[model samples]
Target: MSDPLRETDENVVPQGIDPLRATIRTRFRRGELARAYDWCLEGLKHYPDNLWLKHRAVLCLTRSGALERAQTAYAEFRLHEAHYDAECRALGARLLKSEALEAPLSDFTIQAVRAAEAYAAIYQETCSYYPAINAASLFVLGGQIERAQPYIQAVLEQSENAEQDDREGAYYLHASRAEAFLLRGDMQRAQASLEAAIALDPDNHAARSITLRQLRLLADHLTLDLTGFQALEPPRPAHFAGHLFAVGDGDNQMTALDEEALRVRVREALKTAGVGSLYGSLAAGADILVAEAAHDLGLPFHAVLPTPSRVFFETSVRPVSSDWSRRYDACLEHAASVQEVTSDRKQVGDLHLNYASRIAMGLARIQAAALCTRPLQILLWDGQDNQADRGTAHDARLWRLSGGEQVHLDVPSRVRYRGAGNEGETADTPHFSQSLRAMLFLDVMGSSSVPDDRVPVFVDAVLGRLARACEQFAPGLVYQDSWGDGLFLAFESVARAAEAAVTLRSEFEAIDFEALDLPASLALRIGGHFGPVHEGRDPIQRRQSLFGSQVVTAARIEPMTLPGSIYVSESFAALLALEAEKAYRCEYVGRLKIDSQKQRQPIYSLRRLRRPETSN
Candidate 1:
């Protein structure tokens, strides 16, 4: 659709000083909700009363699946603003609709009806086809077809009369018409309108995704056939993994001919999978081959390196051949984005590669979710599960556990590679006990504002609850410490860390601050990171302590996190994806500069997934 904020700017901010408006709009349109939300927050800091920015901020939260936060923000916005415009009202209704969709079955129809009325009221005030179509759809979903007829008729008439000069507007208009026809039980016209809508903006995957979902919902409710829409589905994002060629091994080493043949197979598999984007490392052998195929197909390649580029090149690329090294360099140069899972200057063990592979898979899944599609895993394997710790075998198994479609290209049995061998370690390299661990840092918000008299109450009510919760996870705790309002915890696994974080939040939220004579604003901000860390005995604490740059990174992430929310580093989220994909949900919250050094990391808001009920 045309920019709603731009059209309404005259009623909000002055034209000359509103340069941030365009940037925010562009980011939001590109599905970068976190970045757009950050920009909106920044704009509001300068112009606190800017209605457009407030609306956009709430919109970002709603789109990012932070419905509770979005509801709170919209409530606060309404408290500050005297008037509610059509856009603001529509936004509130959208929030209601989103929540209604997730409501329990017994409560869903009532909530959906309420949301439908809210949208209908907006449609009545503005004669907008967007809200009218939504009202009709929600009514139909709520089993109020008789009540939906008027709104459906209104949507059809208004959408037909609407201007179609703007491509986005035209697309939505057609989509609205399609929905209205479907509601009227005219399947043929609905399909034609849907096709027209898709034809108008074929490249706008986000918009097409919305249309597809609405149509699917209508088809499900009406028991209509929707198999014809399968062809319009968006291309899936992919994660790739394979063996790194072992150099100077004459017996089973892959020759030039084998490499070329493998590249052809990789390209064919990518094409057959209909992959729009690729995520993986850029190491020599199969990784480089996949990157080259992605580049040739004009697909975006996101490279996830286990360690720093120089170290990865030295260990994984340079050992193969100069030609392979050059190929790796070219892939890096052409990569859409390159993210290092850790800042380690040297490869420590198989942990780094394993971590990077999981991160790549998680990122691809994230991208696919955003596009309303599935993630595909492509592996080059020889049907052998030799390597147990880290290799193509381990990655393939992880993918299977995560429950996704995978394509395996069979490598010749003669291709013997040094899978997770000690090829990267040198004699001079000192080895210390190292393992991948999840670190958590938590700080109490507004701790300084607490009166000294109430400090005892805070200690009893707040810190006490945190201590009790940590005790429940004692078996998984690697290290734990608390001082004043700050707590640091190390967990043996990402699953444990995630469970602990969520449990702590739940425990704290259950506390009664008002009854304890403490500030109601008191809440905890938590941050987590997963990476290889040095485990050693502490001289001061007289206990085992976890220390490394990763721990420092986790500490930096805490101060930036929103109060009462758990924000984790990308590595932490990736581990959760591999180990606890079915138990936790990680929503991308954009990249943030975590320190004064200007180092940035992608952050995700973590929460537990609701379990499905079992039928008796």
Candidate 2:
């Protein structure tokens, strides 16, 4: 079989794209999203089939919050919608606007009604729960409450009959029920249903939006069911005995001898760590090496095949050799669990590779959290820092810098290219690449100004408590470092970081200030934002740390916060909008330009947990 992932030996630039693509890169890195998008769109006009321009333009549109436009571009480019099933979100967003909700006869309501019907058509054809929830939610939104009853009841029936591992869609059903009750003017039942919806899954954006609407419209009268929400059991984190994720260099990067050594190293690492389950992709190099070892050792393998089996075999598996293809096939056939993430990769392009990277890493952590504890990681890479793209070098550095322990094996062949008219090899700069992390900065309100003797003791207690709280939460924080008063943390998900902050706040509030001889209460001012940061060693401290515009932005937001509250940047709030399933999640305070930034960016305050307030 021809290797589909093989790069064409003939290197030719897409016509008229050199200068424009260069300009697009520069503009994109500088945060001129609209300008970059314009340049990319203009380039696309000249080279309509240019994948580079299409992908970049799509990214710009997404960052600029033109999600619908991004979706159109993704469809045009034959790429996955980039967001997880964004058509559903767009449909929900359109139908659930405040005015649309309040008036069944509004023009928006008509448009929403049609959208819901279209979604129902999709459900009829696909039988996926994604559209089913939309079908029912839309009926409720369109004031067809009776029409929603069957869909909601049907979903509940399915949930009751589903296997425990397959009940992922039940959360949407609860949200639909909430919508039904709200439309019928049953406020109390609606609130409880909404609470159940959020409790089931905090990442349900559609449900979260509904809850936020209720809090906004009825805060003076209807208290959010925070009590009920807390009472519901948390999403059980995945756990498995001896599970770990693997990542590293590609086939071309490692020679035959090095492959044997790597395989041995991986086998030893698994055995040494007592890993019984190995989760990663089925890519030809380090991924399969680990898998083969796992197979030999009887470790259950959880695989994420980014593309279809045949496509992956041709593009990713068969590229190296037939031996590799056989191994890949055997691994796939005998894996304990498998997640076919997508089938859109044409040539393992940068975007698709990045997407696969997320799936591989996320499945490792998310599934482990679901079935066991967070999985340990094993990153094998040559010490090269590839700025051109995210690969093993990037993945290894990120895995370690995020405070995930891994058995890192340095291989020489992957260090640099020595073949084909190249001089003696030399690796790129030993720098860790950048990745998006949920950056958090928390400061004890008055730790700096406290008595000199108490400063050390108080700061120690605060940091200790915070660290303990993070471990209690699954997929805990990457605590980069801490000063006398504040600490910096990085996380894979904003939901857990936000939860940790909220929990820590509550824990502190439960402490009596008088018991510690304090004149005032202990409180925390937290600032959180998500962005790309360089995961490298700090020059001054000589320790691994995250540094970038996003990191500094998080720090800038923290001191601006009111004590005892969580202050978040506009970017951070956007993540919450997508991930928070609970009501009273975040409220926009105002826009602040902050130190040196030209744009006045919006900021939001996440409310602390309080007793349900019924009366104003």
Candidate 3:
């Protein structure tokens, strides 16, 4: 018979064998777990003897929420006294600890003992090694690392006989050794052992955890950040939760920002941060501008804006906020109120004090209420304050209202200010203040043709591309709405919004047209407007937008425009004054009436290109 395993490529396996193992190795490298999991199950059936197959299956299954299956496979794998018995024992112990297993299984302990014996038996005969290493991890997990030192020393003495891949095993022994050092309060050796382990495997999660835990213990007993301390390993994901707050004052302060300024600020920020996520507070005057930036960039947004009454703000994208949990990436609330025709609608409402603060507070409360309705992970705040006397003595009271624990603020708690700082203060805080000026709204002219099934993928592609544009241009200011095609945006200035629009037009035209499955001639029509309006949700209109005639005019621009063209309202043009004439070719497009008016309205079309014929 042809070799069963060799019938397929050494890389590939025959049917009825674990195809998932091959796929898992591929996806693990590619970081595509979902598809890998699907293939892993198929592989598991045919190659039960393959240790690599079993390991990958358990990992993928656990990651994919088939935890029960993972646990079962783990248990079964433990039954076999394989060459990787020690590693298998450590993994099983970690799994058991994670699941809070109450009773110890005889098979589990028996397998662990057998594996330890196998290693010890090998160690006694190893003549090439100076130090011996053994099953120290068993003692570490069993809370008796001190008792495991003899075994670890024996394994280390024979380490030369083991391969380089056995370094992790040595580190496992070191981890237990470090724990022993700590138990004896021998800080120097504990630190040295951890350092050695880390030197072997930088991504050693176990070593990293123990090192930090030991450092924290030392800090509790001694002064932190002392002469010999290197910042407690890098802060992990688990460290940030409950230690941060997303705080900002309602500074409606970008009024004088021109298009150049908007682009400059955004561009500079991105260059500095590379790829950072923006979390703009909706109550800030920059909300609309940020949304416009995001729309122009084609990025997903986590809108924390609050609507008046209970109405959900209607948008083209499901607006998610840091409500419910840090993982709440998509909008959860249903339509509570939607303003319809026949009933007047207002998008902008009153400009209240601490608008941004109120919005943030409301977000906290919404998350809190939701948690009460359904138990979920603990919520956290992002921004933080350090000075105890800054009058803003960390709003601990906010947690009670939100009905959830406050997220720890780990990323230094400095106030975010736009302008100048006090004399002699650090250069980090600049001295220029900005004012809020205009809002830009973008709506896809005709989106009915987009197939519903492919909407999400297409939208993600488009929005992801736009997000890149924002990163290239605007950094911290952008928002995304839920309309598959339509996007609502706001900006600090008509000029920046216009610049963004022009850039957006050029970008859309230059997009990977093939990826969108559109003809070569396919393009996008974008509309924009600038005006003085309320930035937050309208309380009186139940969060319905109350944009003045400017919005309606801007909306009309798209309908009257061509694909891949940027449309701007006359009001925005006037704000530009002579500056507008220099940047764009302005022309009188005659007069047109808008949504709420019976009288004809005067409109002007500003094109970067002078001749309309050339544009066509």
Per-candidate TM-score against the hidden true structure: 0.85, 0.34, 0.33
What TM-score does prediction 2 earn? 0.34
How does residue 20 of candidate 3 score in lDDT? 41
Those runs of model 3 whose alpha carbons end farther than 4 Å from true positions after fitting are 1-50, 59-70, 75-147, 155-180, 203-207, 210-230, 238-251, 255-616
lDDT of 3 by residue, 1-616 (tens): 2322211232344454434444455544332333344445446566556666666656654433233445776777653456455445444544443232212343434444444444444445542121123334344334445655776555444432444556555655555455445544566776776677666765443334434543443334333332243322421110001221223333321223332354344434332322112222322122333333433443322343323212213221122222212222122211111111111132222221112222333322222111111111122222444542211123334323334333222222232222211112111224321223344445444455556775675576765566566555453244334355655666665656767777766666677746776444545766665443433444665553434444455566666554555545544544442233335543333234454554333344445632111100
Tens digit of per-residue lDDT, candidate 1, span 529-616 = 9888887777798777777788899999999898889999888887787677667768766568897785456688897865321110
Cα lDDT over the full model 3: 0.40
Say which prediction, candidate 1 or candidate 2, comes out ahead on TM-score: 1
Q: How well is each residue in 500-597 modelled by candidate 2, as lDDT tens digits?
A: 77887776676655665554655788888765556788799888878656677888988888777787765555444334423224544444656674
What is the full ranking by TM-score, best candidate first? 1, 2, 3
Question: lDDT of candidate 2?
Answer: 0.55
lDDT of each: 0.79, 0.55, 0.40
Model 2 ranges off by over 4 Å:
1-430, 582-584, 607-616
